[model samples]
Target: MQLIAHRGLVRSAPENTLAAFADALSCGFHGLETDVRLSADGEAVLFHDRTVATGVPVAAVTRAELSHLAGYIVPTLAEALDAFPEAFWNIEVKAPAAVAAVQTELKPRIERQRLLLTSLRHDIMLSMAEALEADTGFIVWHRPAALNSLLYAAMPHAHLRTLVWYYESIDLTLLQQANALGFRNYVFGAQTDHEHRLCEEFALHGLITDHPEFVGLTVTPPLQ
Candidate 1:
């Protein structure tokens, strides 16, 4: 199974920052995943949460302001992509507000590297699929919900080629269902040693993990 570092293996540095991304690369992970949201100033910044420690909405502040409150530099999507041209990217557009910004930011970069864009919002995935020929995935939890998205994609021929399931929701039946439809099955939130061990026996297309070392070393894909 392909192991993609979740939020660049966050430890010392906050996730979605250049520092965390660098740490992931240093650990020999070729694939890295992060979340994107738009700043008040219209910058497409790499951040996972909707609110900060002060409970202020991330969208309410400019990137600079957010950085100051966050106490660490928050890297923009372009900056992160530029810094890690060698690694495959799994970028999750975390909020609806980020959809437009992410599209604009990624338009020029998609063709430059191997990447997968995912979102829990079907509308965002549909929007992306319609806008670009790049691979888009529906992040889902329940089997019926995942099947619903698959059905829609099949009839309309969407760019959706992958299903990103929550780790707790994964089961043999679900994996079989995804494989039967010829869709890539990537599990998110599988970070602990127990979680990694549980996934070891399953044939997964990829895994979004915070602990890459425990997931066993899968062969890294060739970089674009």
Candidate 2:
């Protein structure tokens, strides 16, 4: 199973910053996951929320304005790709507007195998899957979507290449069912030691976590 650093080892550095992503790679994480949104300038920026702390919508501000405002350095998607050329990226398009910008930025720089594009919006994920050749995944955060995901997984032409669920929403049965259907299963928001152990016991494909070091250590036992 892959241990993906959520927001680039958020505990070590500011979430979604180049620094945070670099730190995760330096610590031997298998990959990094980040949220992407479009700035007012239509630039792909690394940010998690629809709005910043000031309650200003991210799309309403330019990249420079966002960089100066605060606690974290919001790196552009271009900057992140350049900074970490070899690391596998799980880029989440937080808004529909970001899909195009992200596609334009990533097209020539990396191959599809090195990236996984995901979104909570099924339509956006479908759009991205059509727009780019990258591996696409759907994030199921609610019960309705989870049920739908299962049904979708059973379909022969289901575009869902992967299915990620809220860690709390998944159970052994779901994991088995997804695996049986040849769907790669991943979980989000799995931060605790116990959760990491659960991921190992179930043999999940990967998990997103803020504390990669703690989870990695728990999942990687001594050779002896």
Go through the candidates in order and give the clash count of each. 0, 0
lDDT by candidate, in order shown = 0.82, 0.79
Colliding pairs, model 2 = none
Cα error, candidate 1, residue 220 (Å): 19
Tell me the tens digit of each residue's lDDT in model 2 across 1-224.
Answer: 88788888666578999978877877788899999999999889999988888899899999989877756568998888888888888989899888888889877865533888888887887766666666778887754545444556325435456888898788787778777877788888776778778888888898888775557432233245
Residues 17-103, model 1: lDDT tens digits: 897888777777768999999899999998888999999999999999999989999899989988988789999998888888888
Clashing pairs in 1: none
Report the CA-based lDDT of candidate 2 relative to the real structure: 0.79
Any runs in candidate 2 off by more than 4 Å, and if so which?
110-113, 144-159, 218-224
Deviation from native of the Cα of residue 197 in model 1, angstroms: 2.5
Evaluated at residue 134, the lDDT of candidate 1 is: 82
lDDT of 2 at 221: 33
